[model samples]
Target: MTAKQDAQLTGVPSAAMTSLLPGPLVDDAWLAEHLDDPRLVVLDATALLPSPRHDGDHRSASGRPGWAERHLPGSRHADLTSDFSDPGAPCHFAVPTPEALSAALARLGVGEGSEVVAYDTGGGIWAARLWWMLRAISVPAAVLDGGLAAWQAAGRPLASGDTHPEPAVTPAVPVLRPRLWSGIEAVAAISRGEHPGVLVCALPPGGYDGSAPTRYSRRGHIPGSRSLPGRGLLDDTGRLLPRAELAARVGAVLGTADSPVVLYCGGGISAAGTALALTVLGRRDVSVYDGSLEEWSGDPARPLETGG
Candidate 1:
């Protein structure tokens, strides 16, 4: 095999490794070549966000049915809504306990030395959520840039129905990185201007400006947060923008790499997209508010404001 192909399969050093490795995003070509690597676990972490017009439980919206119909060959579906998140939490997309997360991942055949590649049918919003979950537990993971859309566009083969590998024997013990996530109390303090950091709302201008339809009790954003919609980071094909462009967009609000950034959206899903964007820009001091506006706006006590 050529050196490039070898690198793709084993992550061995090659000219292309410079751009592919030491990062959080990989393209469809890289994943396709490595699809059969024993040390790799490719997860279709597909979860559709509920439409604002549909007033129902957002937690019930899942991409499993679609995944069951078609997905990457040999890729197992990782249900973010049910398997990876806290279903009993007060709001949608709450982070599950490390133990719960570890067990769920183990059942998906993930273990030590496994290089995880997560992707979704849509833009990488849901896939990034799973990447963040793995990162929170200190696992080595990356999101498929452009996701399944790009894969299919590349004329890759697809497999349908369920495919289960043996459950992993090694337990996934999470290191419990508290700094990777922010809770409601921490967000409240940040909103109150008692904390030293920037609160970023990753929803669209409408949600941030209070002009959009909302499922939350309140229709606006956290009082002191700034608007930096996560979708703005992606291009027409659902792939992230060029590095220079991405840096410019995030830098406008973040100012410096040292700036502590707390990202949030309708729920935690999109915020993870922004978090992944920041990581791509080499910013380490970033955290996603897990409950996001779901818990914030639903509570009568939390403060929210509308308009830019």
Candidate 2:
């Protein structure tokens, strides 16, 4: 057999390792310990969310200003609203194309061989979004377990001002993985029972029940979806729950269905938390609805359901 065939027999690579990550989740202690690793590129992917309102769609702001004011000592800001999203897409936070993804990573000093750690100020929701993006492309990355608050609580040092590094010597080449993302058509199919899988809404319970205010014109979840709020997946400390506890919660909602899971949120940001949680539980049959409620609600013809 050829060398390629022989190498393929085992999942291990024949060459020396090019990149490494501490899995999809890492606590503040792990980050503090490896703060100085040359191959590590830490990012603050915080997005300032608007306070909950009883009336209408809430506005969100880029967390760059806050990130610029203070961030992890060696970290830089990753503007998820602009740089990491598709500017031309009508819906906000639209996933970027492979080229845009590559350019953004390259500009951020992330090469094919780079290891990444992502965190946010409020919770790890925003950080989980970035981690999901990197993982979808097979880039080694992890979400800081408890985020900036945890780091600060642990008395870690922080820095202010611009810390943007030089462009990566080797630009990132996105190798898109299969079934990591699902489009509107597939989601619509699922809603119509033309498809077989689980539709999980990862927003707060309000979003699932249609009682919550929404940025989109209409509130409520897509038809036949189950609630699995991403916020519920985390503990009071913002770290993930124990694996057994997590599995129990997830399994309870999923309920013995071996079908693939399709996760979605108001825009698309919070769903990553559920995706990350599922990944931590050793699930690979998952996909994120890129359009999510933004796109689904944009079209009035689509049906929605009120209440859980």
Candidate 1: global Cα-lDDT? 0.82
What does candidate 1's lDDT look like per residue over 12-66, in tens digits? 3367443334358889888877788887888999887756773333534678889
TM-score for all predictions?
Answer: 0.90, 0.92
- Compared with the true structure, all predictions reach lDDT values of 0.82, 0.82
Report the number of clashing residue pairs per model: 0, 0
User: To one decimal, what is the Cα RMSD in angstroms of model 2 from the true structure?
Assistant: 3.4
Error of 1 at 103 (Å): 0.5
Candidate 2, residues 1-308, lDDT tens digits: the string is 55432222221224544334546788888888888998898989999878557545667889999998989987888898899889999888887887787778878888867878999986688998888787777667888888988998999898998767676556677777647898888988888899998899998988889887887878899998999999898899888899999999999999889998999998778898899899888776888998899889889999888897
Error of 1 at 279 (Å): 0.2
Clashing pairs in 1: none
Q: Model 1 — which ten-residue stretch has the worst lDDT? A: 4-13
